[model samples]
Target: MKSPSRTILIGGTLSAALTAPVVAAAAPATMDVTITIPQLKVAEYHRPYVAIWVEKAGTPPKTVAVWYDDDMQKNEGTKWLRDVRQWWRASGRTMKFPANGISGATRAPGAQKISFSRAQLGATAAGEYTLVIEAAREVGGRELLRIPFSWPAKAGAGGRAAGKTELGAVTIAFR
Candidate 1:
């Protein structure tokens, strides 16, 4: 037979162990996103600089990814990033370049798929949030698009938005 204190402790531990999975199951959901950058037929065509981020109500925007001209010298690419006006004003000014897992070289005009685990999003609490995508090009145009969705999104929930000039199609799905 166990001492009363030991028995109580074991019971409490067992209870916590059983509840662990339940708590994890209730954690924030993950997202899969695809950003399409359309190729334009222009003499001065330049790959557009793009930024993707998430914003929760009453919270500052958090960058998910940024695509820029990483080939430039002396981190010159970062200077053009601010052309993405909204993202620049929101979180770009203070951020260092090449943010791990959140910055990449510009992609060719096509579908670029990206996945965001709960941890990548900072695991926002159960609530509504907005996904914002902005695009700008040197000697070109600029555009911004936004998609709103709820947190802990139901399986198979997804959305897409289109841009007029600098950007193309933006799609997001939660799982």
Candidate 2:
């Protein structure tokens, strides 16, 4: 038993405590994303500059992530990033040319994985979202692909996708 003020305070504290867990549980989950680049013919030996990101149906796509075009010291990868088109305009165009994340080096032909979390992306950061991947090779053809999924940082929320020869196969595991 307690005074009215004490009872209200305790009751309010209890109410908040009970709902705190629910709020945390409602935060969706994290997403695991992977991308694979394929081997091209000898004539197409240039490792592509791949741009990966998330797109929301109603929202115009924004550049949330990027790979390659980070080796532009002497204008090396400066001209090539434009091949990815979408990423070029979204965030690559004005970038410092060569970023260290994945410059010069090209991904080998095979299945490769890249992981991103809610804490690692924006635009399609949460709620309904679609994953988009664009590959642009020096001599090969350019292609785009997408996977639709919700996100919040689930330990195993992921999906797999196969790219044209320019991209072998992509696997995403959110764990």
Candidate 3:
């Protein structure tokens, strides 16, 4: 009864692309992702606002995967990410409440699973893609976690790694 050693795979610089570059015809696929915010040394777990998205290498169009509820009035969970400037601007700052996918509810320090379909994903190729996770603590600062995951959006039901600063562990699956 021994546990496996988990490693953090950090690659890709999707965040660099804030403008979201347009790409060729992307293969229609679905990406089932799980976001986990590991325990932090700090108190007051105000439920961090997390943003997940995919981006094309050397480009501008970075597809938004999942952005926490940004509706301040309706969801205070979102306003917390102002520190996560990147996501704040890309998504949170929008304050429009995730249009379709999951509801805008603050998640505790645990696993939050969600799935995205091709219908939802505009256009992306199935060659090489990046999985970007941005976590913004309520009282804490922000941290960016990057993982270069090849797509169809679905290859192996594996995860990248958890960021020590903000996220604990992050997993993305095809099933």
Q: Write the per-residue lDDT of candidate 3 for residues 57-101, one digit (tens) a residue.
A: 565434454455455676564444566677556545554554444
Candidate 1 minimal-lDDT segment of 10 residues: 1-10
The candidate maximizing lDDT is 1
Q: Summarize candidate 1's per-residue lDDT along 1-175 as a digit string, tens digits.
A: 1144235435544554577857545542457788888889998888889898889878778998788987688989888888889999999987998775678888888898776755456544777888888999889988899988776676664788998777778888865
Among these predictions, the greatest TM-score belongs to 1
Top-down lDDT ranking = 1, 2, 3
lDDT of 2 at 63: 52
Predicted candidate 2 versus true structure: per-residue lDDT over 77-119, tens digit per residue: 6667788997777656766644433233456666655544354
Predicted candidate 2, C-alpha RMSD: 12.1
Q: What C-alpha lDDT do the candidate models reach, one value each?
A: 0.77, 0.60, 0.56
- Cα deviation at 97, candidate 1, in Å, is 0.7
How many clashes in candidate 1?
0
Q: List the residue pairs that clash in candidate 3.
A: 20-60, 20-61, 20-62, 21-60, 21-61, 26-124, 38-168, 53-65
Question: Candidate 1, overall lDDT?
Answer: 0.77
